[model samples]
Target chain A: MKNYSNLNLMNFLTPGPSQLYFTVEDHIKKALKENICAISHRSKAFQQIVVHTISQIRQLMNIPEDYYIVFTASATEIWERIIQNLSIENSYHLVNGSFSKKFYDFSVSLKRKASKYEVALGQGFELADLPIPEQVELLCLTQNETSSGVSMPLSDIYELRKKFPNAIIAVDMVSSAPYPDLDFSQIDTAFFSVQKCFGLPAGLGVWIFNERCVEKSLALEKAGISTGTYHSISSLIKNIKNNETPETPNMLGIYLLGKVCEDMNRRTIQAIRTEISYKAGLMYYALRESKNFEIFVKEEKFRSKTVIVADVLQTPASTLINHLKEHQITVGSGYGAGKDKQIRIANFPTHSKETFELLADLLIKA
Target chain B: MKNYSNLNLMNFLTPGPSQLYFTVEDHIKKALKENICAISHRSKAFQQIVVHTISQIRQLMNIPEDYYIVFTASATEIWERIIQNLSIENSYHLVNGSFSKKFYDFSVSLKRKASKYEVALGQGFELADLPIPEQVELLCLTQNETSSGVSMPLSDIYELRKKFPNAIIAVDMVSSAPYPDLDFSQIDTAFFSVQKCFGLPAGLGVWIFNERCVEKSLALEKAGISTGTYHSISSLIKNIKNNETPETPNMLGIYLLGKVCEDMNRRTIQAIRTEISYKAGLMYYALRESKNFEIFVKEEKFRSKTVIVADVLQTPASTLINHLKEHQITVGSGYGAGKDKQIRIANFPTHSKETFELLADLLIKA
Candidate 1:
């Protein structure tokens, strides 16, 4: 951790698209001025970059050859898309935390005959704990919950697959995909946003779907249930194969994402994940030392290696939050009913050691 | 357009995040190296920058004092949000082109009762001919149809306000807002994506709503209709006011937008608009001179000041398109059914004079 005495004024700790990479920025500018912006999406020129980038993403994630990466908007939009395309009458949703619950709720709202398998918050899904139904066609899980700071083990998913060979498995890896340990081959599909692990910006949603999901999407499209308005998976796949998008894509964001992916490939997700673990550990150690503060999640297995959630045990959460704010150390307040009870410190890979140290020092003072 | 003879291969002409700015790229590099990616949205430091940028957007657009400028994923999301939040059972959509038709179709699919006033494909909305419905709570129009290369007149919108005082006027200025001469005072609300006129990357949506729309959003929230899952206006407003977002905000995109806005303000929109007009004129003249080309939009008033659409009257559109492609000249193929017959050229302020001439020269080669 760097000394708190001299730090840049801009660093704050929220999550997703909350950080910017300078090289990615420069790449965007160079592309713009070079007249790259004037090229048509349908032309061979644009398609190659898009196609190449997808290959890079797949290889980086160690995705199986059978899977294809499809880009969407936020992972939230994917909820509807998933329901529209993949969810048949009976699907099982494994709900462990806030985001997972939201996804389950959406499936219910869509009136899909879905069942929820609820686990304690922060106690992520375990293969043995899953309720395998006779008629279940698909299983949904969140690899990590951004709000609850939970990361489920991949083994849990593989175990489910082992027991239910016919059931299609889908994972929300918005927060988890950025970490190096995420292997896309274990599940039928994994989706995430660039804001979290990718550390670029928001607006674009990224997904990797195995051949099974693609087939499922085609089946849904053929059945007349449209899972897309502008963000259709089938249409996206067709365009992506050609290094293009069906509609006007967020060009700058995608271009920046390409640069981010290139950089990530160079640094490797392993090195980045190591750095993230170190930062989260520093914050964890700092919280553990304080009698007034306690970590929000109870289980070590479920704790997020990226986003750290801590609750103020002695002082009123708001008071401790206010104290930190006075020192210009910004952190996330609790969401929903947990307000004023917990604080979230996001350890994005883009953050420097000095920034983490400064934040740790501020928390100690508070 | 820079002597395609000497240029490298590859081109992209999608509407936004269309290209990167060199200066913006440099700034991104500086931002990344400082390990400054860890900035928090609610921190005073980041909040100040966001607030300032929003203020700048407001000022640049000459938005009314009562309206608020906020950001979202893309204007596409905003389209759904507007209908879900503000449509009070009935809306009158002005369908002059493809985009307007798409918006109307979306509203209809949502099971909302909406009426449409159609203009010819190349024509703009004429206030004198429009029907003012007393039951219609919102009047929707697209200032520029990127697909058809048509731009509606701002003066017509102002005139409609005088006649339809009870109805709120909402304009999709996604293509026109970034250019000059957008009179915000006459309209109640306007939405734009950062990728187009703003000259930033895609992923960020900017919408300025009047007091009436805000009240409508509040009313919907009170009524308990899920305003929208991710595209809710109420959530966006709350987040923006907090210097936060309903979901993880796209920080990198917004940061780049802020930089782009600064550069825009330096030159001013009027100056940029002038350059755009100059380029448009050159292209229009070139199309007029071409042996096989004819302007698709018949009337001068109906033509988009920003984009030009030309129909290949003699040679097949693809033949000419492929010929241009061989030279590494990238331009748009028409959307939907017009794909085989027309080409669209966009002349943003950033496109240099030499670029326009080169494109013209290439067309003249046939």
Candidate 2:
């Protein structure tokens, strides 16, 4: 086995499209050798890949039996699909970051009666303050805000589900997945891109939705609404029954995802989560001790363990980013308006404990 | 150097995703080592990749100076984007095959006043026979329909441009891009997926459009119409100005496409097209001389050089496919309703002359 730790490769700490799993290179090579990318989506061989991938994902995530896992181009596309299919006229959003805000904007752009309970940057939603109207057909929530690194607790998600029993709850777990130990039965739909916690390449988004979401899409189609063309829930469900996609998908990505998820299953999700928590704790401790940086999220409980966002206090965030880059480590700058003032670091499973220790040392010294 | 020709790899003659270029494996390895998949889409490095790839594509395809190259999830998505952005109400389609027919369906699903000049599966449209209404805002054509291996001659496209000066002409070159000698100025917009002639993996679609398409999208947005979300023409154009995508794309696929195009440019497009014509000629001749198979498209002018469809006369198409599989070669079964009655073979740039000769021997013998 090659020593991934000692390999002369630049380690990426950016949230998503982040460092790939050590096994991904081999998986990709196997895919190429097996001619996976060349197979037709309609072929039984391609269908086997899709079926195996969905099964592996279910095993890894402990996905509910009632939920269906469908593929999309990206999590961004899923936001639009959700708005088109599940939302009738009214939808409610809990916006704490850029990605969550974009989902709300999608609903509005579709000429839906969309309303949101907005919070400041680096803050998670307060369940008591959420004003989800009974008439709202869908409630959009960001389980982990990728931009600001603010994560809503599982308790908050469960609480929202109780409060809005009739409304479909859609969760955006783009930057945090296979780690958030959530009860899938509590949420009607959830989505995450494989480029994130799955430690795979970009291009494939995994959307998990229950029967309620499917029934809603059928209802909208019956009402003569254009849910979507190829990627609508009804179309996806029809294809998924045959273990295929509505269009030619990233077959290589899907194949790699299955292999990676299978690898993850072998390692066990509990063990992976434990390692993630430890790495997050070490990094957080290092940031707190550093004179130049502090944790961006004020509330300790709200801080995302997956994506760590830090506010540069005494020095520019670029200085520390450049310092890490000099060591052949790549981290992310803050998103949107916080571009210069903060830096984001991903604590995904692909990132080893040794790599985190090296980054933590540099961050503390800086 | 790896002897790709002698390798024990199964040669795929499916339309697409067909055989990958010999250089793809090494390019993918380089991308993994360089951590291309992990980089931020907004980063300067990622922007460089995007710009370089677009430049290479322009060089290879002889795209016009005024044309802008934007990326989408797939060519299927591009059909919807063209309808949403460029068409106001009335759109006309030339439906030669399944893929072309789907574009018409997308427009109709969007509630556009869509009309089509339909033809038989293995037939191409006659320019004089087309009933293009004067009020039609868009004319959708398939330069080379992948489903039935029917191609519209460049002269037809140019004539359509002259006949319908007011209508936006959007061409689907999904299975024939980078190989089709198209005059970019004659068509307002054209789109293709990289999995086909580009000899890369799926998940990235290239949409080439001129300023007229952009202006139409802007006008639609101004009129309170929803062009799209995230990947609207306006959003893609804005990102293209910065050499970035509106969302996280298939970075690995894009990187591989650039390297392949660069490889193609180094070999010279004229030389590649010459080789393609030669290989296609050899395959078609073998099919014509064979006792078991015959050319599906009756008209020589309409037959696609890239995808060759053959009618099985003496044996079921599946028997030939199974025979090829036994020899570690894979050719596609006919698409849709003609599944068992016909076979499709792709004569893409990645397919070597030696490989084609070997397949030709089998085809002639069978």
* Cα deviation of B253, candidate 2, in Å: 0.7
lDDT (Cα, 0-100) at A228 in candidate 2: 73
Tens digit of per-residue lDDT, candidate 1, span A299-355: 777788777888877545778766765665556766556666888777776777888
User: Taking the tens digit of each residue's C-alpha lDDT, what string does model 1 give over B272-366?
Assistant: 77888887888888888878788888888878867788888855578877777676655677767788888877666555667678888887766
For all the models shown, what interface RMSD does each have? 6.0, 6.7
Scanning candidate 2 chain A in windows of ten residues, the lowest lDDT window is: A1-10
| Per-residue alpha-carbon lDDT of candidate 2 for residues B290-317, written as tens digits (9 for 90 to 100) | 9888799999999999999999986677
True contacts kept of each: 0.30, 0.57
Write candidate 2's Cα lDDT for A179-260 as tens digits. Answer: 9998999999999998899988888899999999999999998898888788889889999998888899988988899999
lDDT of each: 0.71, 0.89
Q: Which number leads on DockQ?
A: 2
Off by over 4 Å in 2: A1-8, B1-8
